[model samples]
Target: MRITQGFTFEAAHFLPHVPETHRCRRMHGHSYRVELTLEGPVDPVTGFVVDFFDLEAAFAPLLQRLDHHCLNEVEGLENPTAELIAIWIWDRVKPAMPMLAVVKVYETAMSFAEYSGG
Candidate 1:
């Protein structure tokens, strides 16, 4: 079974590695959405893979760091593409959420990326 929780934050970033003429080269902000998916068997006792509150607690600190901040200034997010952002969140949250199976990042309503560890 898989249980997923979503979070949103607003931050600005510019893709430095993209071509100078690329539109993304200029700074812009996104109401970024990240979803954490935890995969495991549902426990007979709890009837759920994991408690939603536990997931929220594990992610709150990272949310604070990412919200209203420049993604390029975040320690591991200097390049900050949707793909890299997914990887960055997975790296920070996985230890606290061992069951985490995927980190999905939405740069826009229609564009997103997913990372499942390696």
Candidate 2:
């Protein structure tokens, strides 16, 4: 079984390569949603794959880094594609939670990308 936790952050981004008149070319925000999945044997003491509270704590710094900021201005995200963002977050939070199996980032209600085991 897998356990997943979700968090939300608001951030702005612009795709410079797009036409200047494109709506996404202007700095705009998305209510980004991140879902992290943990896979492995559950802890016998807590009877959970991973503690939800612990998951939230693990993601706190990440959330702070992205919340209310311009994602395009962040280092390493010059384009800020959903794929890049997923990988960026995975890199930062993976070490703290060894059980992580996948990271899914939702740019909108219908669009998202998954990064795993990298």
- Most accurate candidate by lDDT: 1
Model 1 agreement with the true structure over 1-118: per-residue lDDT tens digits: 9999999999999999999999999999999999999999999998989999999999999999999999999998999999999988898899999999999999999999999998
**Model 1 Cα shift for residue 79 (angstroms):** 0.6
Q: Candidate 1, after superposition: displacement of residue 54 in Å?
A: 0.4
TM-score, structure 2 vs. true: 0.90
Listed in order, each prediction's TM-score against the native is: 0.97, 0.90
**Tens-place lDDT digits, model 2, residues 1-118:** 7999999999999888788888888888899999999898977898998889999999999899899999988888888878899999899889999889999999999999999966
- Clash tally for model 1: 0
Candidate 2 stretches greater than 4 Å from native: 19-22
Residues forming the 10-long window of minimal summed lDDT in candidate 1: 84-93
TM-score of 1: 0.97
